[model samples]
Target: MRKITLTLVLILLLVQSLFSHLILQENTAISTTSQFDTGDTAWMLVATALVLLMTPGLGFFYGGMVGKKNVISTMMQSFMAMVIVTVLWVVIAFGLSFGPSLGGIIGNPAGYVFFQNVSVLTSWPLAPTIPFLLFALFQAKFAIITPALVTGAFAERIRFWAYLLFMVLFILFIYTPLAHCTWHPDGLLFQLGVLDFAGGTVVHMSAGWAALAGAIFLGKRRTPNTSPARITYVLLGTGLLWFGWFGFNAGSAMGANGIAVQALGTTTVAAAAASMAWVFLDKIWGHKPSAMGACIGSVVGLVAITPAAGYVSIPHAIFIGIFSSWVSNVMVSKFPKGKIDDALDVFSCHGVGGMTGMLLTGVFASKQVNPAVVDQGLIFGETTLFLHQLVALIGASVFAFTASWILFFVVNKITPLRVSQEKEELGLDLTQHGEFL
Candidate 1:
C-alpha cells in the first residue's frame, strides 16, 4: 500500500515537472508591458520572502507543541507544504484562485495552468505596482501555510499519505474558491464590499473550520498528548510569526505606502496588547501566567489583527488584539477539555481569532484610514458594512467546514487516515517517517 501511494505521488510529481518545463519554455516570450514602481516592487520582493518564511515559522510553532515522539512529523507537515503547495500553485491552483472570475465563484484554471502567461516584467493588474510573478508567489505562500495549519488538529496520529491527498483536495476545492470569492477582483464578496485586508477568511477561517472538521471526522486519539513538548520552540515560533506578519499584513497593502505603514504600526500594537491580555487572563483565572500562554496570546492577537490591519487605526487595533486574545484564550482552555482531540487548538487560535478579528474589522473600519474603504464600519454609523462582514463570515465558515468534512470522509475511504494503534503508540516519527527527535 505504501509503495502504491508513493509511486502515485512520484508520478504526479513527474507530470507536474513536465508541465513546469513547458510553462518555462512558453514564458520566455510572454513578456509583460506593465511598468512597475521600484519602491512597491522592492517591498513586494521582500514581502514575498517574508511570507514564505511563515510556513517554516509555523513548523516551529506547531512542532514545539507536539510530544517529543511527534516533533519531526509535526514539523515535516509544514515543510511538506512548502514543497508541495508551491508546485501545485505554479501548476494550476493560482489560476483557480486569481484567474478571471467565473460567476464570482471560481477562476478559469486554463488561464494560469503551468503559469503559462505569468510574467516578471509586468506589473500585476491586481496590484499594478508590483510584478505579477511576485503576487503569485506571495499568494502561494499563504496557500501553503493555511493547510499546514490544519495538521495541528490531528497531529500525532494521521497517516501522512492520507494527509497529502487531503491537502491537495482542500487546497483545490476549499481554499481556492474561498480565496476567489473574497480576494479576486469581481469576486462575490469583493463586489459586495466585504473587506479582508489580509486573509482572515481565506486563510485562518478556512484552516480553522477545516481543523474542526478533521477533529470530528478523525475521532479522538487513543491517548491524547495534551502537553506541549517545548514551550521555548513555541515562543521562538511566535516571534518569527510576529516578525513575518509585518510582511504578511503590511505587505497585503500590495505596496510600501502609508497604508502599509499603518498596517505595520497596527500589527505591532495589537500583538503586544494581546500578549499582555493573555497572561493577565491567566492570573485572573487563578492560574499562573507562563511563557507559552503569552506566546499563544500574541499569536491570537496577530490573527485577530490580520483582517483589520489596514482598515482600522492603532487604538481600534489594540482593542481588536485584546478582545481576540481573550476569546481564543478562553476557547483554547475550554475546547481541549472536551471529547474532541484538536491536539494543539488550531480552531481555538486560528479559527476563533480569525472570525473575531474579521468581525471587529467591521466595527472599526474607516474610510479616513484607507481610501479604498468603500463602506465605513459600524462605528462610523454604517451597519451595512458590519452586516456584510457578518454574512461573509457565516458563508466562509459554513463552506469551509462542510467541504473539509466531506473531503476527510472521501480520503479516509481511500486510505486509513489514522495509523494502526501500535504504530501510533510508537509515535509517527518512527512508524511514519523512520526518524525521531
Candidate 2:
C-alpha cells in the first residue's frame, strides 16, 4: 500500500515538473483587442459563487439519500472534491483542459501549467470580459462537482481514500478530455459544431456514466436499506441546487447579455415544468406525489435543458423539461436496482436526462436564439445539427463509461475500492472516517 501510494505521488510530481514552464514573460503579452467590461465581469463573479455553492448542495442531496450511518461519509465525498480538484486544477488539470490545442484532441499541458499565464489582466478568448483567472475559477467549480456527483452511486460501500484516488484519475483522464472536446474552441466536438450551452455532455453525462460504472464495479451494498436518511436534507439540497442552477445555465453565456437572460428564463421554467410533470406522472403511476420525486424530476429537467438553455426558446425549454423528466423517471423506475444497486439512481437522472437534453437541443435549437448556431434544429427543417448531436452523444457516452470503468479497475488494484463486508456492515462513517451523524 505504501509503495503504491508513493509511486502515484512520485508520478504526479514528475509530470508536474516536466510540464512546468513560464507561458507568459509579462502581463503586457496579453491581447490588447479584448476590452474589459465591468458589468460582465461583476455578473461572472456572482455566477462563479453560485456555481461553487452547488457542490455542498450536492453533498446534502446525496447525503440525505444514504443510510444514517453513512451520511457524513457521503457528504464528505462531495466536500472533498472542492479541496482535491481545486488544487489539481491549479496545478495542471486546468491547462490540460483549456490550454493551447493539441491536434484538436486535448490541451497542451505545458501551455498554462500552474496557471502561469492566467491573470486578472488577461481574459479567456471565449469569455473576453472576465479575467482569465476568474474564468479558470468558474470552470474549476464544474470540475469539482463532476466526481462529487458520482458518489451517489456507490455511496455506502466505497472506501474514502480509494475513492479519492479514483476521483483524481477520473478528472485527469475522463473529465478533462471531455471538457476540452466539448468546450474548447479548437476541440474536436467544438469544430464539429456540437452545441453544449452548458454541460449536458461534459459534466452530467460523464458523471452519469461514471456513476453507472461505479455501481457495477462496487456491486450491491450489504444492507439494502432504501429509505433516505432525511427527506428534509434532500429538500434543502434541492433548494440549493435549483438556486445554483441559474448560474450553471446562465453563467455559460460568459457575459451578462441577452443570451444569459434567455438562459436564466429557460432554466427557471424548465425546472418548474419538470417538477410539476413529475408529480402528475407519479399520480398517474399510482404513487403518491412525493417530495423526493419532485426534487429528482426538477434536477432531471435541469440536466435536460442545460445543453439547450441558450439555443432553445422558452416553450421549447418546457418541452425539453417535460420529456426529459418523463424519460428519467421511467429509467429510475425500470433500473435493476436489486442487481446493479445504483443507490440514488444517479445514472438514470443524470445520464439519461443529459442524453435526452442533448438530442432535444438538436430538435429545438434555433439560430434565432443564438447566431453562433451554424444550423437550425430539426424542427426548423435542418437535419445537419441533429445528426451531429446524435453522433457526439453516442461517442461521448461510450468514452465516459469505458474510461470510468477502467479507472475503477486501476484504483481497485492500487487500493481496495470497496469496503470489506465487515466494514460495510459497520457503515462507512465509522469504518472509513470514524465519524457519524
Candidate 3:
C-alpha cells in the first residue's frame, strides 16, 4: 500500500511540471511578439488624436469657402460624418476592412460587431501596441474625412437626409473595401507593392474621385459665389491640419523610430515648399497671392508629399510639393470650364495633388529612405521604384474613378442624389436643417 501511494504522488508531480513548462513557453512567445511595445501604443494614441483633429480642420476649410448662409450646414456635414462613420466602423465597416481576408478583396466577417473578442491590446500589422479597436478609431477618422471631403464638392447643395444615407452606404461599400485592399496585410493591392505611405492614394485619391462624382451628380451650387464667411477660420483650420498631419504621416510608421522622424521632417518641408511654390505660381500668372492661396497651397504640398513621406528625401519632397501645387492650381482654374463645378475644388486639390504625389513617389523614392527596397533608387541610379510608383498611381486612379462613377450613378437612381433647384438656391441651412446660419 505504501509503495503504490508513493508511485501515484510521483506521477502527479511529473504532470504538474510539464504543465508549468508549457505555460512558460506560451508566455515567452507572447512576450517576444513584435506587437509588444509601449512606445508604439503611445504613438498610435497621438496619431488617433491627430487624425481626429483633421475632421474639424476639414470643416473649417470647407466652411470658409462657402457663403455665410451655408457655413453651418457645410460644417455640419463633417460633424455628422464623424458621428455616423464611427458607428458604422465599430459595427460593420471595421470588420470588412481589417478582418481576416476574403480572397484578398476585403476582410471577413469575424470582426463584425467589434468588442466581442477584441480588446485594446489586440495587435495590428502596423500598430501592435493598441488594440484592433484603437486602430479602428484611427482609421475611422480617415473614413470620416473622406465623405466630408466630398461635401466640399457639393457644398451648399444636396439634401442633408440624402447625404446622410449616401454616406452610410458609401462607407460600407466604398471606403471599407478600398482601405482593405490598400492597407490590409494580406490585401491584394498591398501584395502588389502599392506604397501609399499615408493615404495619398487610399484616402485622398478616393475622396477626390468621389468628390468629382458627387459634383457631377449634384450639379452646381447656387450662382453668384459669395466670399467666405471668415478667413480667420480658414487659417485656424489650416494650422490645425498642418499640426495634425504630423500624426497622420509619422504615426503611419507604427513605431517611435527613425523612420517616423524622417516622415515628419519631410512632411513639413514639402508643405513649406509647396506654399512658396503656389505663391510663385500666382505671381507668374499675374494674380496677387491671397492668404487663402497660401493656406490652400500648403495643403496641396501636404497632399502631394503624403505618399512619398517615408519613401523619399527632403529634396525630392520639395520638388514634389512645388510641382504638384502648380499642377493642382492649373487644374482648379480650368476645371470649371469643363462644366463640372467642383465647389471647393476638392478634386483639383486632393485628387490632382494625390495623383501627382503618387507619381512623384515613384520618381523620388530611394532605397536609402526605405531599406525594404535597398536595391531601388530614383535619383538617376535606380528606376524600378519609379515604375512601381507609376503602377500604383494608374491602378489607384482607375479603380477610384471607375468605382466612384458607378457608385454615384447607382445611388442617384435609387434616390435623388441632388436637392431640388429651389432648395439649393434657398440654402441648405434653412432648406435641409430648418435653421438659420
Q: For candidate 3, write residues 60-131 as lDDT tens digits.
A: 888888887788899999999999888667656788888889987889844344333345545676666566
The models' CA-based lDDT, in order, is 0.90, 0.91, 0.80
Candidate 1: list runs displaced more than 4 Å: 1-31
Q: Report backbone clashes per prediction.
A: 0, 0, 1
Q: Candidate 3: misplaced stretches above 4 Å?
A: 1-35, 374-377
The TM-score, computed over Cα atoms with residue i paired to residue i, of candidate 1 is 0.95
Q: Give the range of the ten consecutive residues with the poorest summed lDDT in model 1.
A: 15-24
Q: State the displacement of the C-alpha of residue 296, model 3, in Å, after optimal TM-score superposition.
A: 0.7
Residue pairs in candidate 3 whose N, alpha carbon or C atoms collide under 3 angstroms: 120-131
The Cα RMSD in angstroms, rounded to one decimal, for candidate 3 relative to the true structure is: 11.9
Candidate 2: where are CA atoms >4 Å away?
A: 1-21, 24-28, 31-33
Pairs of residues at least 3 apart in sequence or in different chains that clash in candidate 1: none
| Whole-structure CA lDDT of model 2 | 0.91
Q: After superposition, how far is residue 67 of candidate 2 from its true place, in Å?
A: 0.8
lDDT of 2 by residue, 56-107 (tens): 9999888888888889999999999999999889888998899888887788
Error of 2 at 191 (Å): 0.5
Candidate 1 or 3, higher TM-score?
1
